[model samples]
Target: MPQYKLIYFKTTGVSEFVRYLFSYADQDFEDVRHDITTWSKFKPETPYGVLPILEIDGKTYHQSLAIGRYLAKEFNLTGSNTLEDLEIDSMVDTINDYRILFSQYLWETNEDTRAKQKEQLVQEKIPFYLTRFENRVKANGGYFFGAKLTWADLFFVSLKPYVDFTIGFDTLKNHVALAEHAKKINAIPNIKKWLDTRPTECCIQEFLDAKHKD
Candidate 1:
């Protein structure tokens, strides 16, 4: 019964960003999850006909990213200043760019092409982005963006597992810098505790099954 509450689909796609914030902050909130059969009813309640809605102290937070930023800033997660925030936003944008292809791959029907796309990701996109991100890490003085672990860092850190193995940033192997970032995030005591006790989501396996189904 914390001040913020999040409503999202049972699946992980859209709401996870907000989820990471609350979890990292060790804040409490109501989690309302709706299945497909329940989405029609759930959709209309949101500001933009979306499922993932954040209500802060009973007021509604419409956009997902806005909500994440708000919560992050409130809990000392965002950057120290506008410049740092911009860097964090840039990293977030990079991940968002790749997510476009992720959505495309999710709905694509062709079998051979999908596999080929995955391979392409593994070869050109994965390594390229990973290297680019790795370089960006060094350029920005290590971590994701700021010297301190901001919300942006937590958000991407929360997402690193999926990236290292999923369609977005999944080209990691002997990636020293990137792996170091991941390791650092993993070592956060609060995060470590949450990871140990968090509930399971089947959508992870579902994503794999759906992609490889062809």
Candidate 2:
């Protein structure tokens, strides 16, 4: 096996799904997390100056979804065929789209603007995507794609904490299928173990709290 190392911020952020992929496959990796101070010095050396980067052997690569897709294929969490792969990729990308939107709200500096974004996110965007995601899980019998677990499922489940914190409540409260899907993913032995042992402080929450206090 090639030596693997994952480099990211102290927060789960986009890297959490990649960690889930590693856990689900029972693969060992060096999870290197950096705080803002450390990240500043290291940023110049990174491929894109952004994480989460995966170092395979000694070669470094950037982009979270690309790394995730590569690992999913390696771990047999990917689709069985090209068409199935397309479906899984589509779902994963869609989930990422909403994540980007939520991140906008989380990072917004203007209080009034942030409040407006939150209102739109809570009232319009969250429901629009989650309701469809719920139906997709229902159609696939609780999985995100096809008849089996895929990286798409891991990707969505890994974002649960971040999503909940961004919305300031359970984002899946009305989306029963999505909630159940998350439950099933969390119940996986390796995944459950990782969740139980991983650091609990999501830096996104700290960022939001700090902003509120300003």
Candidate 3:
């Protein structure tokens, strides 16, 4: 067995799914959570000054999705074939796009600008993605690819809490399939255990709260 160490911010952002992957595989790894104060010291040691690095037997790997894909393949969370893998990768990329968009609202300092962006994201972008995701779930019989669970499902469900907090509403309310899909993933034994054990507060929510307080 390879030694594994995952280093990321305390926030879920990109590392959460990798953590989920580990949990799903019932693998033991050192989860190192860093914060802003410590990141500067840690940054120079990492490639590209970016994080969610995975150290496997002392060699470092960067990029969250790349690490995720490797782990997915290793753990059989990846789809069975190439086409299915492509589709799953596409969906994961789509969710990453959504996360990036939501970060704009989370970081924007101007109230009016932030409000406008938030409205557009909620009223237009989110629904568009949610509907598409819902349809995919419906098509796949509750999972993202086939009958079994895939990393795409884990990726989606792992990022959901931050997305919901940033949207400030129940974005899945109108999407029954998506809601049920989330429920199904949440009920998975490993995922449920992780959810119950992890930190309740999300990073973006904490950032927003602190910004308001300031």
lDDT of 3 at 62: 96
What Cα-based lDDT does every candidate model obtain? 0.68, 0.88, 0.85
Cα RMSD to the true fold for all candidates: 3.5, 2.0, 2.3
Per-residue alpha-carbon lDDT of model 1 for 41-127, expressed as tens digits? Answer: 667767788656877778887776777777878788777789878878777777666655555665566778889888876667767
How many backbone clashes does every candidate have? 1, 0, 0
Worst 10 residues of 3 by lDDT: 199-208
lDDT tens readout by residue for model 3, 80-173: 7899899889988988997889878888889999989988997899988888888888888888778679999999888876777777887788
Better TM-score candidate (2, 3): 2
Candidate 3 stretches greater than 4 Å from native: 201-214
Better of 1 and 2 by lDDT: 2
Candidate with best TM-score? 2
Candidate ranking (lDDT, best to worst): 2, 3, 1
Weakest ten-residue segment in model 2 by summed lDDT: 201-210
Quote the lDDT for 29 in model 2. Answer: 96
Runs of candidate 2 with Cα error greater than 4 angstroms are 205-214
